[model samples]
Target: MSKRKIHATDIFNLISLTDPQWDKHSRKFAFVQTTMHEEDNEYRSAVYIGDLEGKTIPFTTGKGRATSPRWSPDGSKLAFVSNRNEKSQIYVMPANGGEAEQVTFCKNGARGPVWSPCGTKILFSTSVEGVQDLQQDEEEKKKKKHPEPLVVEKMRYKSDAKGFLDEKNDHLALLDLKTKEISLLTDGDRDYGTPAWSPDGKSIAFVTNLEENPDVSLVSDVYVMDLETKEKKKITNSNGFYSALTFSPDGQYLGFLGHEKEFQSATLSRVWVTKLESGETHCLSENLDVEIGDVAIGDFHSGNVNPGLMWTEDSEGFYFLMSDQGGTGIYFGSLDGAMYPIHLPDEHVYAVSMLTGTHEAIVGVSNSTDPGELYHFDLKSQTRNQLTNVNESWKNEVELCKAEPIQFKAKDGWELHGWIMKPAGFEEGKKYPTILEVHGGPHAMYANTYFHEFQTLTAQGFVVLFTNPRGSHGYGQHFVDAVRGDYGGKDYLDVMSAMDYALESFDFIDENKLGITGGSYGGFMTNWVVGHTNRFKAAVTQRSISNWLSFYGVSDIGYYFSEWEVQGNMEDKVEKLWEHSPIKYVSNIQTPLLILHGEKDYRCPVEQAEQLFIALKKQGKTTKLVRFPEANHELSRSGDLALRIHRLNHVKNWFVEYLQKA
Candidate 1:
């Protein structure tokens, strides 16, 4: 279509569609489309409405970002979260569009708005300062001085993005539309969130860690409170990780997505329906052998939340996106536990909403070649209709490479799946430098989705190879959990086997000029690869974990994740941690490595990169560490726009230089 390949900086021109909500009458849908502002260093989001005929209209034009749109019961009003007034709070406005009225003014602001069926009240969640902290802040404001020191009392005092949580805790609150007043329905020492109102409006179901030693267990349960009695009772009675609580329209069942910790964090999330009368839970897709929800790993759409369990109009079934092998598609699940397939290939459905009246759905689908766009699928006719061409003009202006799927076998004869992107505007019989990229989450899947980094390499005349190794989602539970307690085991070989297959099968690859790069868990593997083999002439590891002993105590999920995956606590199994650590095998490395890390990346921490750099330096090995200031672990996805572009340039420059030199 054009004479030019897609530039790496084209990521800025892409728009991300998320949180699609259907109106009550099913005549239209409201959703959020986000775009990045380089100078402002923020993602600007706005709500929009579209009809069944693909006609679109903007619903809100706030200067700041907005999201989480919820249509009112009668479809006359729409409520959403916006930061236009200096804080994220709930706002209600006419469904057709008009001036919005702010509903909640809590100190910490409000979000996650859920409308009641009666339209008399709105339910939302907000964080509030503790009693002592509130008093201290008030006193400081009176004296016109800054606040005092931060006192930490919990094991988890800080997080990766919202660092240093201080003492504020999220709690459920209710807003009365008639009086414009807000009241606290539930509050205590612990936090409460993900509130869903009962069908009859007599009860409210919410999630919390009210268990003993909430910090140690890392488990959440659904609790329903009787509005009249002000009493709450737990429905789920197991040590399972649960969220996305939705009560079936008939009010007889509570539907959710959860796993019983059989395989811990690596366990495939299955769909479950709980009987409200009997307290019985049935896993609808237990034998489906695929993980529910979109596990499509990529760098384009940042800050997207899963809108779990979109129920059908009749409430007899549900529609959800399932990650399988390398593709993610939408599937239907019924109340009787029967599943049906609605086929769409090579597309990742990240965010979706259904219009029940017409037996159709509005889906946000994307693939390797496409950034993403909204589509309406007719269930009765089994056909897809394009609703928005958000990236059509940009796509026509540039040439993008399409991914070709490949299958290979590991050393143990395990089948592995991967995709290779030939260099953009390829010429037959001409060899090109190859680059191997690994995804971060050992449990996350590398789906057939848009990957800006991979495309960037293809634009650089490099064939990109990416695989869903063992421990990656989109496979069965056993396959996904196979990497646990064996970090550098078959998972590492699976990736290597993928590369072996590519080099052996594709004659257009220059194996001698190979390079490797990854971040997070993938970064750990990149370090492992350099230490074990000298095949790659250069390597780049980003936000990597070099030592498990320090990772256990420093990371946000380190303490528990280390014990669950590594199979033992850091203190009890010091030898195992060091034995599998890449730092321990640093002497075998010969490739020139580049360490990229965010200074504020608390998930892996900059210290991990520092330790690996110092180890390579002490051994007189070639390495360089580049630190990004004020960036977190999500630098590649939703950090400062300038930093994101620069990071990609750094990676591209490193590979180009080393591959050419080799």
Candidate 2:
């Protein structure tokens, strides 16, 4: 097939494949497929079921989203959630073939369903309206007037997507199949998540933050409730982050992904197991030293539930995924604390499903060239077979850059890893302008996954480069925590060192015409780079942090994120915060900069971008600000479809004006 240049518009055509679940008795596999609707800027999801060797067909079809498909205990019914109406509601149908019926009708709607072991009832999570709020709403409806003002008293008032939280918490509800009645379970002024039913069906395990001030304390514990007695037993302390909870088939052990806050926000999620008899809890992956969650960040997939711990039928060992060195791989962990990685290099295993009896697995993985697709993996043989060709159109049409791995030593003697992507069409004698891209999280890695923005830049004849500097996951504990309190120190040199290695080792890269860009922490680095050096001609900072001092007071994480990562607090460490802030060095910036921000972003609030843009503009330095409405920290990854393309255009044009030849 002849190669063609890819565009940002192609983003809509991509179908995100995720949440593969297997029906053991029926031998049918179901997964969620989502595609973007450009006009309305909405992503529509549908559920699909396929056999091992038969054709794949859509089980539910609609313009609305239908996701999180799960087969019942008997394999006779499929349960899922759909947003066919305003809010997402639970729905179920026969697993083999039948019309899906909406199961729950609620004001806030229900999602994330878990079926009972006997398959007679289903349980899901839904937000509960406070008694006062519900009465106020009713009064307002009767009066045919505007709603009354929301008087919220919580520490955290507004969230990113849900908007003004206003005294609402997600609680559990149990639904009866025969009576079609719902029983509210675990109701309080707290949020619950990830419900799991024990094999005996007498108990339900869930996670909740029952603290007086949940947003401030940020403590969640695992709890198991007796179905008949309604007695709850708390299994964890109020110390750290814990989620992805599951119970073994034998109901003898509890498995979950959590960290003890020993490392604060930089702590990697470890697989923890608790023996029900002894009440002894220990980390299985403590020695493995890798993040135990999805670390591959990309734009294609959204609305993913944690795969958690998938136990074998015998309950001897369990299968789980771990992130290491820019890729996610399935690993087998024994009860004896032995762990071994099932090597899946150069791929992001975003989701995985398995059959109970055998070493059979189906994984949703995406690489540099592929968007996302499911693969039939043989755990015994450690081989994977392609199960779906969902991205064939883009694969056949685009001439994408293949990433080559590179390693270099920082000036401080620390070894760093990175990848280089040459432009689509490369020639020996030509020099191409290069972009040094940085990823967010500061704790996240730049993986070998398909990045649409990078692909478009390569299509525009620019060599794109990225690296996992210190403070990035995939590396060990120390490396991922190195940037704490030393933001602009060695980590700054690590990225610049990658740039130096790229210019020295790759002859096609033009050192004189370089550009830099990043979002969140990456944006902070972009601002830092342009201020410290004039090597880059242009830069773009998106959803970025400019001043740690102001950020510590304004951002949603302002309360503690600064203290955790920047080692700064508003009351105690103001001076240190200002010292590492990029805004402090803005006067020395020589590179023309473009500031992109999401107005609704609470994490790295738009005020951060505003301060930087205002500072650069007042200094008479060349700078521009591009703001997207109703967008949050996830703007680049999964924002409004139209605005995503617009943001990409702004980025492309800024670099085109400065880096590309006339």
Candidate 3:
């Protein structure tokens, strides 16, 4: 049978595998398998166990979403977070397969369960609002028929993901298995997360911003707490953002991934190991130019927990994920500050679980065509064996396009990386209308990952070209930080240069019927691109930024993000912000633009799209705005299934309407 061409709605049929966890003593490993419930317009996930021999089976089942699977120290019990009830709570079951038991009944909810070294306790995070009991909190919430007036006081009062901020703050709690008692380990207005237990179980290391006004600062420090004395010591000074806390096997060093805000968000996160005895800190990946965590942006995967510092049994070295040259790979780092690649394949390794005392690991790998799957990887041999085919059925039914990697020089002679996907069922000597796709983040790389949007566009007979420009990660620190203060300057030239290189090098591309699209930072670029030049015939901007002046006050991270990226703020560089804003050049746009945005997006809020659409319509230039209700900035990635489909269809239809036909 002939395979069918991929469609925008094909996302519903694909499965995502993430958060792989290996049982220390056994060869078996468990991973979270997520699939879209099309009928319900929701995603359902369950934990599945897979062995090195390639056999896989579900460990958790029935309806509600389950995620963050973690094995106990003895590998006898499995702990995970599920939403089978009204609120998501922790569930623990025997690793050998039996009935699972709900472990926590926190009033707000509980998640991110970390099994204690002794297996006698579990460390989890939950939101708390003071000394109120669960019953009282529920009763108090029920009494309020309507939500009370949200009196916003702090600058960080809302988030694109969590919505409006409440009085409750996320705090760490300790659950005693034998006594069935739960105790709050840390409390107050400050939020805490990413908890790691020492091998001896006497102390816990977690990440938090203890600043009095943490809403204004971006610094997150790592803190270690003594369980017996409840004494807390700050390991990192208030200098940068830090997370992914893990204790070495020997309990002598606390390893983590962080940056010193040298380049703000564009700074490469290095591997830092702090000696507990002398308080000496060392950056293991200081010499490496690649980003220390997974920065490959894709739309298919869900709940992809980065395997930060997976230390070996000897504690001399650890494994980590690094993004370099448009791909994410596994690398090893030693205490003496040496780094080496373990498996640097031309694919995306989203999650990994290394077996103790061995070089073998269960890694979740994905590429341009494959959605994602679990693989038993041998780090020493640098070989991988497929262990699970979660998206096999979808792959068999649909014909996917593979992206061919391309390298070219930017306008200023700097080398850049990107990929081009040929239109589905391409014929020789026939020129195809091409769409230049720009990824968001401006700091995130467009790597060799399964991007549903790219496939859908290619299936619609449009060549998709995506690239990592100056602001993108995986490149050196200087390249990543190049676009910080020069938003539409060199970054714009880089993308335009990519299009120029593609048109000059490839005979199959139709330069006249060109189109452009992007979201978030990419959206901002799309707007900027159209306003600056009429090179493209069509454009689609999603969750974009238009005016830096208004963006600094409206967006959730706008105040700081604008200050960091635009190098200006309302206070000192007001004129500079306007000069860099795309809205300032609205009258120059000639391309027919489609403005797509989430109604509830706080990152590049809907108003950004609204401002652009109104300006275009007032000028009598072709433009349309489509907003997805109840959606946020993540509409393209992890939003509602129906909304995500609608978003893809809107983008595909817009490009097809302007770029295709006679």
lDDT of 2 at 146: 62
lDDT of 2 by residue, 1-662 (tens): 56988888889878888899998898779999888887887888899997777468999997988998989998999999999977788999998787889888776778898998889899888888653321114344456566889886654776667666766788888899889878888776678888888888888888888877776787778888999999998888888889888888899988999888888888888998988778888888888888888887676678766778889888888988888888888888989999988765777888888874787888888888888888888888878788888888768887878878888899988989988999988899899999999988888888878899999899999999999999999988988989998998888999999999998898898878899999899999999999899999999998899999888767777777888888977776789999999999989998999999998998888999888988999999999999899888888877788889998888888999999853
Cα lDDT of all candidates, in order? 0.85, 0.86, 0.90
C-alpha positional error of residue 517 in candidate 3 after TM-score superposition, expressed in Å: 0.1
Q: Lowest-scoring 10 consecutive residues by lDDT in candidate 3?
A: 130-139
TM-score of each: 0.96, 0.97, 0.98
- Please identify model 2 stretches exceeding 4 Å from their true place: 130-152
Q: Tens-digit lDDT track for model 3 on 18-101?
A: 888888688788988888888988899999988888888999999989998889989999999999987899999999999999
* Candidate 1 local distance difference test against the native: 0.85
After superposition on all C-alphas, the RMSD of every candidate to the true structure, in Å, is: 2.1, 2.0, 1.3
Best by TM-score: 3
- Please, what are the lDDT tens digits per residue for candidate 1 over residues 29-65? 9989898776666678999999878888888885788
For candidate 1, the clash count comes to 0
User: For candidate 2, what is the TM-score?
Assistant: 0.97
Candidate with the larger lDDT of 1 and 2? 2
Cα error, residue 472 of model 2, in Å, equals: 0.4
